[model samples]
Target chain A: MKQDIREILAKLGGLPVSVDTISDSADLYTAGLSSFASVQLMLGLEDKFDIEIPDHLLNRRSFASIDAIAETVSAVRAGQEAA
Target chain B: MDMQISLLDRLFDSGLLIDTGVEGVYARSGTFEDVITAFEGLIDRFAGNTGAEVIRFPPGMNRAHFEGSGYMKNFPQLAGTVHSFCGCELDHQNLIKCMAEGSDWTEGQKASDIVLTPAACYPLYPIVARRGPLASGGALFNIQSYCFRHEPSNDPARMQLFRMREFVRLGRPEDVMAFRGEWMEKGKELMGSLEMPVEVDVANDPFFGRAGRLLKNNQRDQNLKFELLIPINSVANPTACMSFNYHQDHFGSTWGLKTADGETAHTACVGFGLERIALALFHHHGLDPKLWPASVRKALGH
Candidate 1:
């Protein structure tokens, strides 16, 4: 999951630096990821995971870091399984 | 496309729209004004039976109201705040000196008590909420106002400052949805009468930041918003000339608005982008309104 996230982050344009040096919990916006790029990244994540991110989980906190995104994905997947 | 450039050039050449040397800002010529007025009159005739409370708000609203509206939360980039020079004598002199020296003088201006309205119906909510619960049939308002946004684009259809004519309804979930549905069909018919081919599809706002992406998708998936699009500028990328949105208790929760049964009042609005519609007319019928098709002219009551 972490490797996939890293690949997605690297592909997002407008990120000032490489995603490797940034820690999992580091803020993506502070790392220079723009809103447009974040949207692109969101679409990419949705495609890769084949899971729809619910409205409630769509916020700055959810995309603040790779770790946050991984948690959201896992949570959504768990909910799907329960359903 | 070459057609778009030619259409824009024709509008400028015919003096229908006087360019202001700035992208997305223009002074409408008398002919342009006439077309807008005609279009509005046609809307009025169509809505004559509906007892909509007509209201007109100034281009700017109270700054405090703006801060509380949560507009900055979603569209901070497009929001425009009014500023003025409220400094004393010494500060004024300093500002003048800075201007003379070709330095930044605008920094001396402070934020004013007013902010340019981003949407036509923004100021209506809190006022309506203050009136307590809505009546049995719900509340309906006909509002028109000049809205300002910071989007500077070369597309004449998209202006930084433009007028929006909106009919806002607040009531129960079913009532608001019904109203939106009725208007969705009505808006399409109105456009067709003008001989403009329009397509209605679910759409989303350009929300702010990462959360905005989610909100946009949620809005689209839930079918909260729909737009009447026409191929004005380009056939490939049509522009939205009118929009129908269902804010299902979003404003009710925000403004403490309630229905007669004490539940949060659901809200919906049908907004017509006036300039875009006029531009669509020009695009479809060519530069001359007089030479437009007889069906279109009769539709506009020519």
Candidate 2:
């Protein structure tokens, strides 16, 4: 999941540095992810994971880092399965 | 709500505002115009020496540029586009007939190539970008325009059509931040000179929809916007008379704006809500400018 997240970030994040250069807990915003790019990243993640991120999870924390994003995707998938 | 309606009624009754039978739209009387003019002069006295280029644009801007600005993507609810009845004589006849029948005559109106200017600075970026790279010292501009929004309300401060006076800076991120910081202080001082109580607080634009929630949160978390608030119609929710925004490379990337060194330029703008400021003066002082405090009068050259 983390590798897939890094690949998506590389394509859509518009960061100045490589995604692999940053750790899973590294702040994406600090790594040059812009508000506009973050939106694009969110869309890319949705397409890649085939998961619908709920409105409540659409915040900075959900996309703060790769770890946070993976956790959010897990939670959404869990909710989907339970339903 | 009573106070809001009463204030609107009083302005209409006192001839300060002429009723046009439409909510959030009114004609300003000579007295009201005078106050706005004086306040503008005061602003000039403060920023005139900054050597900023002065530009004025009509209330409508090119529709293509408006689309490029991405305003619709964020605040689609507040945007207003200009439309016209562009059809043959047969269609015109039908339009007239529809209007005569008290039906939706505007349904046939086609979207024009122009949209109402959302803010004073919206039209500046493209013009600046067309001029090539910025100078080493960057660029500063003084602009004022009649802005439009779709929100209609009884609060005099929240007009559907109003004037916004803005000073925009384009350059490095540090310089842009400094410009906003300087104006934040200058804004408070300018308001203080009029003896009006004020507060500065972080703010975010009313972005639209569920995706907008993320944008709003990101903006607030980064402290990208601030507003100088003064009580006007309601004390509980003071009106934002002035705003300072730091668009770090957003406009630069969108407009292809570049610095002398070929780097993406950061942009910042400080905007003063002219009508809202006038309303605040009237709310704090007496409606009659002649009865305002001596210091306030002197500051505005009233």
Candidate 3:
């Protein structure tokens, strides 16, 4: 949700990048995020937060940017806690 | 089964499958006739040996047919309707008045809506429902269905008018799966015998939009569908030669189809793209049917 995080994610291209440059609201597609790269990003986020993404959540909206992606992750986590 | 039956004897000589060109809608170009003939022969031989009776359904289904079947709930985008203006009258005066009122009408007319059959199986359900349940065990229907879709892509593989040569088998859950599995194997075997290269893998229907994407993934995970893919021109993205699907009690429940013990019937179907297959063979091999390799020609009943 931080502006710095959005800037970092926006610059994160198709290739793996240092965590320092990652942002929360980056435009993944405009930032050169390929389909394969999105999968890679999913894996990285799973490792970072220890949250497993269900297969159904694999889509454009889930990978649009760091802020959107974080919102989904938070929602999933909150749902898990409530359950 | 390997009786070396004459091509004509197997099909066209009281052949089970028929060749139809609904206003050139379903016909192929530069090789459609020969392809239709070949598919007719192929399906006739296959269906005849497998105990299926050929049935060519009407051009379209009725409006209530889909409404009763919950088609509008499941797939409204693919549904099409028959429309006509019986009588009407309109003029510039009417147009001007409508424009001023922010309403427009060309004429006043009587219109009734009729649903065009989405898939070949839509109409079959009603017919079978009226039959008062299939005999004790199971039944297989041989259908060469003409179907239409709105978003017919220019990709020759996707056509507005295409023939879905379907083998609809209904019975218990196990029976439906077995039928689909058996035909999946048979399709591969047939393709192999014809010397055509093919691959069998999990397949999907052209479900529409966002929700459809989720449904398609669910279909894959449930193993409800499989496809026989053959390289039509490019080896990278192959055309789906055939699809074997098991609909577990979906249609049966909708139509109230039941077995002897009173449980809903399980249904499965294997679809062959007759014209698409023809295009593949013609594109790969040439237009001359006689010149095709012996095994290939015989497989297609050339």
Best candidate (score: TM-score): 2
Model 3, residue A2: distance off in Å is: 30
For candidate 3, write residues B80-147 as lDDT tens digits. Answer: 67755554254556656777888845444333556666777777877887888787768888887777
Top of the candidates by lDDT: 2
Q: Mind listing the fnat for each candidate?
A: 0.18, 0.59, 0.00
Worst 10 residues of 3 chain B by lDDT: B1-10
Q: Score the docking of each candidate (DockQ).
A: 0.12, 0.62, 0.04
Candidate 2 docking classification: medium
Which portions of model 3 show Cα errors greater than 4 Å? A1-55, A58-83, B1-31, B89-113
Give the better candidate number (1 or 3) by TM-score: 1
Candidate 2 lDDT over residue span A1-83, tens digit each:
99999999999999999887999999998999988788888889889999888888888999999999999999999998998
Q: Write the per-residue lDDT of candidate 2 for residues B1-302, one digit (tens) a residue.
A: 99999999999999998888888899999999999999999999987599999998899999999999999989999999999999999999999999899999998899999999999999999999999999998999999999999999998889999999999999999999999999999999999999999999999999887678789888888899999999988889999999999999999999999999999999999999999999899889978999999999999996
* Better candidate number, 1 or 2, judged by TM-score: 2
Which candidate, 2 or 3, would have the higher lDDT against the true structure?
2
Error of 2 at B173 (Å): 1.2
